[model samples]
Target: MGIIDAHHHVWDLSVRDQDWITGPQLAPLRRDFPLSDLEPQARAASVDRTILVQTITVPEETPELLALAAESDLVAGVVGWIDLTASDVAEKLGRLRALPGGEWLRGIRHQVQGEPDPWWLTRPEVLRGLRTVADAELVYEVVALPHQLPAAVSAARHLPELTFVLDHLGKPPIVSGQLKPWSAAVRELASQPNTVCKLSGMVTEADWHEWTVDALRPYADTVLDAFGPQRLMFGSDWPVCTLAAGYAEVVDATGVLLAGLSPDEQAAVWTDTAERVYGADRPNQCRIRRVSPRGDASLD
Candidate 1:
């Protein structure tokens, strides 16, 4: 089956330092991770297309990602960072779209998880900026912590026109093994037709040295039941996922978590859902050829 990794990131440390990779735990990510480093691993896992997501919240990062996507065969879409609360956010988005390879800009994102205020997404100016994103026909990716999910749900309810893609299942409390508040909050977010969730980043949330597919099953099953496969997409969250598991391991673990679904349902999670949610139109946006499981080649 074809696969579209809906969330992955690449960074060049030589260009600028990643301020977040400060402590010993994140030291592995301090070095540069260009698309050249990721291409082979993704190809080995049969990932036909990928959505290149933003790592840091900087004005220059989006344009850089767009230009990189313009030259890549695997990066089909880009979910870049934007100042959601900027008064001139609309004009800024327009300018980004006009830059080289800007047509690949499918969505916008912010590190809402790092915000001191749990309700940051519900702020008035942020809401206005989100409306502008919708007006531009772009999706908004929410990288929020579990405590911030309520605000994410509130924002989704406030703007039905904008598609909200929840990254990493709102960073569930897998390590602690608690599911009550997170599960309930996820259900509420899925209740909004405009929202979708990514099945990713769970490995790092668990014990990096001892996490099993079963440990991730509870949280995975929670979203599967809440959002259904059509509203859930698979993402390697690569490079970051390498902190806990390899690229193939993440893909295999997700496969096991989704083993109970029908073939069609699995297909939705693997590729179709992402293509629809991220607007990855094969004819116009992506031109990568598909390599079948049995070594046959076909146009994507």
Candidate 2:
């Protein structure tokens, strides 16, 4: 079975600044982090293919990611960003899919966590754009914070046709070690059959300097219980996760968290869920092959 990393990111600082990396706490991500820098670590962790996600809300970024996916065997798909509020969003999505590596454009995302309004996702214009996304057969990745989850739930309920992939378990408050509202909200979102979640970004959300797998277990278990293995998938969160743990640490930590599940259930987290959700099993994917260093077994 192939290991499909459902979420990760790459950026070229020299080409354009990731304005979000401003504070001293985020200084480590200041340098250029292209796919070349990530490939080695991903290979070491046995990750064969990845979904290159959007970092900024800029439209141009999507085309670049799509082009990168077309050229790189490791990047099977891209979750690009678009202006959902634009009147011509459907036309713009069509234009993006018509680009060089258009087929690799699998989904669309916005930094909903950055939005001040909790109900932003439920706006009429946004719902209209989401319909366009669904009409094009692309999923919409929900990048919201815990407080914004109710709106996410409402949006999911309103647009049941759109498959909403929840990123980072709605950015749960793990460091605080409380799970009241977050747990209830998560269950509500998961109740919608169109929703799924990625088990990623937990390390960074915890106390970056002192997070332990034990501290993250509760949140992971909550989502697993709510979404189940079939709707849950593994995501490295890559360069962002570097702020707390390296690629291998994140992978190993996920293994520890999922150790209690049966092998078939674990397989869904490691591979099957992502492939089925993102349609990565499609024939057009490049399917990069890498041999585990311990032996010559190829993950082809």
- The 0-to-1 C-alpha lDDT of every candidate, in the order given, reads 0.87, 0.87
- The positional error of residue 172 in candidate 1, measured at the CA in angstroms, is 0.6
Q: Which stretches of candidate 2 lie over 4 Å from their true place?
A: 283-300
Summarize candidate 2's per-residue lDDT along 30-139 as a digit string, tens digits: 99899999999889888889999999978878999999988999988899999998999989988998898898888899999999999999999999999888777788
Looking at model 1, residue 19 earns an lDDT score of: 91
Q: Which pairs of residues collide in model 1?
A: none
Candidate 2, residue 120: Cα displacement in angstroms equals 0.3
The number of residue pairs in model 2 that clash at the backbone is: 0
The lowest-lDDT stretch of 10 consecutive residues in candidate 1 is: 287-296
- Candidate 1 lDDT tens digits, 1-300: 469999999988889888999888988888988899889988998897999999998899999999998898898899988899999999998999899879999889999999999999999999999999888778899999988999999999899778788999999989989998899999999887778889999999998889999999999999999888888899999899988999999999999999999998999899988887766754224321221222122222
For candidate 1, what is the TM-score? 0.93
